[model samples]
Target: MFPIVSKLPDVGTSIFSVMTQLAQECGAINLAQGFPDYDPPLALQEALARHATTPGHHQYAPMPGLPRLREAIAHKTARVYQVPAPDPATEITVTCGATEALYAALAAVVHPGDEVVVLEPAYDLYGPAIRLQGGIPVYVPLDSPTFRINWERVRAALTPRTRLLMINSPHNPSGAVLTTEDLESLAALVADTPILILSDEVYEHMVFDGVPHRSALQHPALRERTFVLSSFGKTYHATGWKVGYCIAPPALTAELRRVHQFLTFAVSTPTQHALADALETDPAHDQQLPAFYQPKRDLFRELLAASRFELLPVLGGYFQLARYSQISTTESDVAFAQRLTRESGVAVVPVSAFYHNGHDEGLIRFCFAKQEATLRAAADRLREL
Candidate 1:
C-alpha cells in the first residue's frame, strides 16, 4: 500500500469529541459539547413522526431544499431582519447542517491561492474548510476580554489575493455578539473589493441583555456580498437533527448549489417538514430563547461566584469563558482542561483549540447549553475547584 499524504495533515480528533469521550469515561457532567441536554419541542417531534410516513416526503428532498422549509426560512428572515423576503426558490439552499453550508460556501467562492480572513479564537472548522479549497486563511485576532472585531486589523490583512472573509457572531466560545457598527465597519472594508463574506450566524437567536442580533442580511452592502449560514438545530434545540440553511443572492446561491448538489444533495426530508411546521406554528420561538436561557446563565454564574475562576460577560450564545489562571498557573489551557476533566469531573474545551497556532490565553470554554439540572450538577463539581 502506498502512503498517502493527508489533506488536513494536522487535524486530529476534535476537542469536543475528545472532551465528551473523557467525560463519559470519567462519569463527569459533560458541558464540553455545545448541545442541549433537553429534548426539542414535543410538537416538532410529533410533526416529524407524522411527516416521516407521509408518502411524498419518504424519498429525497429537492437538491436545493424542500420548498416549504425554504419558504418558512424566507419569511422568518424577512420578519426578523426586516429585509425583503428573499425568493426562496432562487436564494436558499438547505444543508445537512451549518457545517456543510459553510464548507460548500468556501468551496464555491475560494480558488487555489486565494486568501480568507479569519477571526481568531473562531470556530475550529473555518481554517480547515478554507485550506481544503487550497485557500490561505489569514488570521486576525479579535480583541480579548470582549472578543470584538478589530476592524483595522481586518483591513490590514486584506490583499488583492483575498477571496473571502469569514465571520461568526454570537461568536462561539467567547459569547460576544456583533453590533451594527461592526457590520458597518465590515461593509466599508470590503467596499468595491472582490472579497465575499461567509457569515456564520448559527447562534443568531441567542443574544442577551436587550441587544438585537445584527444579521449580515440587515446591511445592504453586506447582503450584496455575504452568504449567511444559519443552523435550525441551534435554534430548535435539536443539534442532533443537523439541519441548517444558507441565504445569499441568486448568483452565490447558484454557485453554492453547484457544490451543495454533491455535498449532500439535500437535508433530511422529514426533519425539513418538522422544522417548517415548528417555524409556522410559533414564529416567536426565537424571540423567547434569551429569556429561556438567561436564568440558566445566571444560575451557573452564581454557583461559580465563590470559586477562583473569573467569569466573563456572556452577552450571547450558551457558552461561557472563564479565566482559570488563578488556579493553575503551571498548566497550559489544554493541560488544565484535561486535568479538570479527570480530577474535578467537569469537562470543558480550551479556547486555544480555536486558534491557528494553539495560542493559549489561559481561558477555557464551557457550554452552558445544557439542562438546568445538568448545569447545576456541573456547577456543583466546578465549585470544588
Candidate 2:
C-alpha cells in the first residue's frame, strides 16, 4: 500500500452519520440526524418538477449562481432582515450548501498559522475545517445550559493572529438564539480588529416564542466585515438539495468565490430555477415557519414532561437538548446514546460529539423536526425510559 498521510488524522466519520447508521441497523426511530422526516413544500416540489423537464435548462448554473435565484436571495435578505439588499451580482454567492460556504470562506480568509476563534460546542465542522486550511482553531466554550456567548471570554481569545470568528445562531444541539444585544456586543468587539465573522444563520426562520433571528448583515458595522452563510435546505426542508448561499462584501465575495469556483463550481441549475420560482410564488412560506415548528417543539417537550429527562428550553431551531443524568448516571453520553438506540428504540446524538475532544455535559440532542407521528412515536419510547 502507498504511504498516505491524512490531513484530518484525528477525524473519523461524523457522529451524525455514525448514529444514523446505528439507528438504521438497530431499527430505532432515527432522530440523531438534524433533518426533517418530511418532504419540501408542495410548491417547491412542483417547481422542481416543472424545471426538470423545461427545455434548455439542463446545464451548469453560472459560476456565481443563476441570476434569477441570486436576485430572489437578495430580495429575501432585504425583506427578512430589513437591511439593504446585497448586490446579487457582486455580494451574494450560491454554494453547494452551507457546508461548502463554510469551508470556502475559511479557505479564502485563513492563512497558515492564522487563528480562528470558534464558540463551542459548535457544529462539528468548524474546528476541522479551520485546521484543514492550515489555520489554528481557538475554541472558546459558550456559557453552558444557555449556550450564550460570553463576550468577555471571546474578547480574551483574540490575538494578532486571529483571522475569523465563527458563530451559529439557533445553535445546533442547543437551540439558543442570539439576541440583538449580542450582535451589538459583537459589532463593538470587532470594531477595530481585522477579524472577520462567519455567521451561520441556516435556522433563521425557526425561532420560537416571538424571538427574531438577528443576522450579521443587519448590523452596519458588522456587515462590511462579515461573511453570512445561510441554507435554503434548512428553510425549505430539502436537505438533500444542498443549496446554500453566502452574503458578503464585494471584496470578500470575490475571495470566497475564488475558492468556491473550484470547490463545487456551481450549484444545480434546475434546482436554482425551482428555488427562485418557489421564492416568488410562496413568499410567506418562511414567515409561517415558526408557527409550523413551535407546535412540534412543544409537543415533543410535553410528551417527555413526566420522564426523568430534563428538557432544556428551545428558543430557536428544531433540536432539543435533554439532560439524561437521572435516567442513567453511570453511562457516558456516547454509551447512553447507543444504549438508548438499541434498547429504548430511540436514537439521539450525544452533545459531547460537538466538542473537539468529546467533552460530556450529560446532554443528548433530539431533532424535533420530525412529523407528528414520528415525534409521537419517539416520545412514546423516550417516555418509557
Model 2, stretches more than 4 Å misplaced? none
What does the lDDT read for residue 317 in candidate 1? 89
Name the best candidate (by lDDT).
Answer: 2
- lDDT (10s digit) by residue, model 2, range 1-385: 8999999999999999999999999999999999999999998999999999999789998999999999999999899989899999999999999999999999999999999999999999999999999999999999998899999999999999999999899888799999989999998999888999999999999999999998889999999999999999999999999999999999999999999999999999999999999888888889999999999999999999989999999999999999998999999999999999999999999999999889999999999999999999998898887
Error of 1 at 382 (Å): 1.0
Candidate 2 whole-model C-alpha lDDT, 0 to 1: 0.94
Compared with the true structure, what per-residue lDDT tens digits does model 1 show for residues 1-385? Answer: 9999999989998989999999999998888989988989899999999999998987899999999989999999999999999899989999999999999999998999999999999889999999999999999999998899999899999999999998898899898999999999999999999899999999999988898889999998999899999999999999999999999999999999999999899888988999999999999999899998888888899989988899999988899999998898989999999999999999999999999899999999998888888888888888788
User: Each prediction's TM-score against the native?
Assistant: 0.99, 0.99
- Determine which window of 10 residues in candidate 2 has minimal summed lDDT: 278-287
Return the TM-score for candidate 2, rounded to 2 decimals: 0.99
